[model samples]
Target: MGAAGDMSMRCVLLALLTAAAAQPEGPRLISANVGIIQVDCCFNDTVVDHGQVVFNLPSKCLQLVCNYGKIIPRFLGDPGRSHCCEFDGLLYAEGAELAGHCVVMQCTRKGWIPRGDIDDCCKHCSVYDDPHFVTFDGYRYDWHGYCNYSVAQTDRTYNPEAGVFSDFEPCFGGPSCLGRSTFKDHKHTVISLGHSVFNLLVNGDPYAVPLVGAEPVRCSSKVHPVLAWRNGQCTMLLGSSKLMVQHCRHRLDVWAHPTHADNLDGLCGHFNFYDADDFTSRQGDVHPLEYLPSTFPHSWRTLDQTDYRCRQCKSCPPPRVERLCRADERQLAKYTSICEKHLGSVIDRTEGLEGYLETCVFDICMMYQDRRNDREVQDWLGILQKNVNMAHMIINLRLGE
Candidate 1:
């Protein structure tokens, strides 16, 4: 059963790899191109006398959700990376309101009905208003940070040993409420990339119409920016599907760098490609800490204890811990060395796949909507996924002065 669980983890990793590798080479996230929109979200009116109302949009359309029962984790990686982990730690999903437990059959249509708050449901992926808020302290997190944060991930588990995220606090402030802390000197750099939405139907064309939003509703813009976090004076925001097709494949991998500042928190919000810190000091006058929540698990120790920003606390070991043989007592050292080398591989491949996403899937979305070639559309998705999914990430952080 344990092995079966591991296999399931691997399958999820493969899907993430596919997403990373399929990075779109275009302008950040274009509202018309990528990201999710809840407003005007279509849903069939369940006129049934006591029928429930739920947002029946695609999992992608849902940024965050809340409901009862176990949390069904989908994938955890960068916005455009192929590498994803099974959230070895716990995983938590929040809800605006919790409806009574009931069974939902295969009802698939788009729109929302009146049942309760938006939080009373579960899906493949979930959104955290201020993903970093669930923490004990105030600090927003990034895509990579949430994926790799041992404490946050562990809390999601339904195990008594894993504990519940009740105190996890509900997030409501939108994506950027948490400060954005990037790799190295908190300098703001805008990176452009493409976005792709795979057409599930094999017979439909990849570029066929109905590209996001309702068929009759015209999309205002192609992309938009979502504020994910705040870090002191330095804020980080991620642009979505706003770029051209060619640049979409450029994953955030290249953004990885180092910092030794005091606000490193349990897990540096700037995750991916490397686990290095980029802040030198919270009082650096350039970077400052906020009252946001990012309190983390002790398991997430700092890369360097001397880097006052990072405090070593309890942390969960990597999944491959047993893979390291005690016979090779030195494997502990080998483990760190390997992680340093492999930690960010997911980012690299995800970045690589971004190009393919632009060329094959996203760029032709409009074309597919009009052409309606299901087979061709499925073929594109197949190629993109086949090319993108992979295991683990390659970390390549070069220490600097």
Candidate 2:
């Protein structure tokens, strides 16, 4: 009984060892002592001893345990359950709709699904050549005032703390060019564009551009403020807002987040996506078309009119002069062709195209006053073309194209 039992037990042990070796490359029985068997788990070429827990599994969502002669797998949580997306410290469940920053997105198991149509998510407004203003609602008008004006002011009702205030200083080149511009957001992030294109200030401190390498310069501790210079243009990003100051031309292009829609006031209009009532004043009174040049712009002037830089026009060109300017078929055709060349595609989707053309004609007339030569007119036209290009770029960027 002793010899036969010993030989048969040795043979059984050999068979068990062979089976363990033949097992797929995972946890397997390494040894046997009396009635006990030693198990080990293999993960990423590392061996885990029996009764030991493996915390660092290939997938962080799972863990492994080496049991007696077997490996047990466990999940950190319910693997089938969908996770929520956290934004601005708020959690949104799957399929939840989120609207903010001028965008509407749906939360999904994988990630966010942005709205296909960008217009439904963002809004744009610009002030360009000779300081022609275009409201967010697409109302176009000319205000030849030289005072510090509020380009936009956030509606306090929607967000008592959030505000965006800007001012334009008169430049000497043309009838009125935006010489210096200042923009301030709710977070106290200030961006100023000086008379010189290279001069940029953030929070009253000069910010160097083309930073070190290919990376953009970012400032501010709480909010995300980015400044980058590319292709002779300077683009600034503050929170969800973006502003592009065109080089040389001093054209100011602003794109506000979708959340700011209907919450903006001042020269930029109500931003409610309606052009009819864009002529609203600072006191929240909507003005008629006849009030644009005088009553409308004067109502939105900054409270402090003490700035020495502020210079009002002595007097506007007489209505007869403006009419003659518009009646010039030769000059009108020239300006119209330039506007069509740069903003042709953009005009199809946006408003204020006709307004831009009229503004061009008026500015050129003001520039010369008497008889203007071809050279002076051509130079002014070049500036207008650059501004139009900047406007086109801003529109494309807002559309996410």
Model 2 C-alpha lDDT per residue in residues 141-226, reported as the tens digit of each score: 76655656667767523222333344554433334456566665445566666655655677766765542211123354221233
Instruction: Let me know the TM-score candidate 1 reaches against the reference structure.
Output: 0.17
Q: Give each model a TM-score.
A: 0.17, 0.56
Give the alpha carbon lDDT tens digit for every residue of 220-242 in model 1. Answer: 31111211222111112211211
> What Cα-based lDDT does every candidate model obtain?
0.23, 0.53
- Which candidate number has the best TM-score? 2
Worst 10 residues of 1 by lDDT: 241-250
TM accuracy, model 2? 0.56
